[model samples]
Target: MIPGQRSRPEAEALPPLLRPRRRERPAGRRGGSALVVGLLVAALLLALGAVAYLWVVSDAWRVRAVEGEAQRAQLVSTSEQLQQRVDALQSDLAASDARVEQLAAEKARATDLREARDR
Candidate 1:
């Protein structure tokens, strides 16, 4: 009836697709929906945090395993080097023992020749 307003029949005459829709739920229900969404978001964040924690723990375990392998390798190399040194020392000792025995036998032969000459 007014200059700027359309009557109910004129408003209804528009197509259903162009009609303004009213919210069916009350204003109080909106808060409940928001709370549910917030809880869902929090649950998602918690799950993501758990995944990150597991990833970090797994990486730490892998690092430790690698470090352990490195240490084992170093120990094995050190043991081999030590064994080589021990073998070399044993060979040198054996050579020295042989030389000492040969000197002793030569000294005994010289003593026997001196005794025969004296007689």
Candidate 2:
């Protein structure tokens, strides 16, 4: 017997269930369609991932814009409160000056009356 050749009886002795099945298509032809499908699926996943990333980034920008508007509103409210305080202080200062002027006029009248009595 040759080193690698099988005897005809030995080759025929294997059961049909244990024999290797032959493919209808060649090996090169078999994987081509599957490769295209795999690449398309990969491309679809990549596109979805990019869209999700953009959505997340846009949402972050929206959140930042909302926070900035809130901060601006808060600053405006604070500035208005400070202006009110300034106006109130100015009104109090004007009332104080008026009272001081009235007191000085009364003191002058008293001095004039005293001098008139002395003469």
User: What TM-score, over all chains together, does every model reach?
Assistant: 0.58, 0.53
User: Over the stretch 3-115, how does candidate 2's per-residue lDDT look in tens digits?
Assistant: 99975644357798766566588778769989999999999999999999999999999999999999999999999999999999999999999999999999999999999
Pairs that collide in candidate 2 are none
lDDT of 1 by residue, 21-97 (tens): 77699877998999999999999999999999999999999999999999999999999999999999999999999
Q: Write down the worst ten-residue block by lDDT for model 2.
A: 6-15
Can you give the lDDT of residue 40 in candidate 1? 100
Deviating ranges (above 4 Å) for candidate 2: 1-50
Alpha carbon lDDT at 53, candidate 2: 100
lDDT of 2: 0.92
- Candidate 2, residue 19: how far the Cα is off, in Å: 29
lDDT of each: 0.94, 0.92
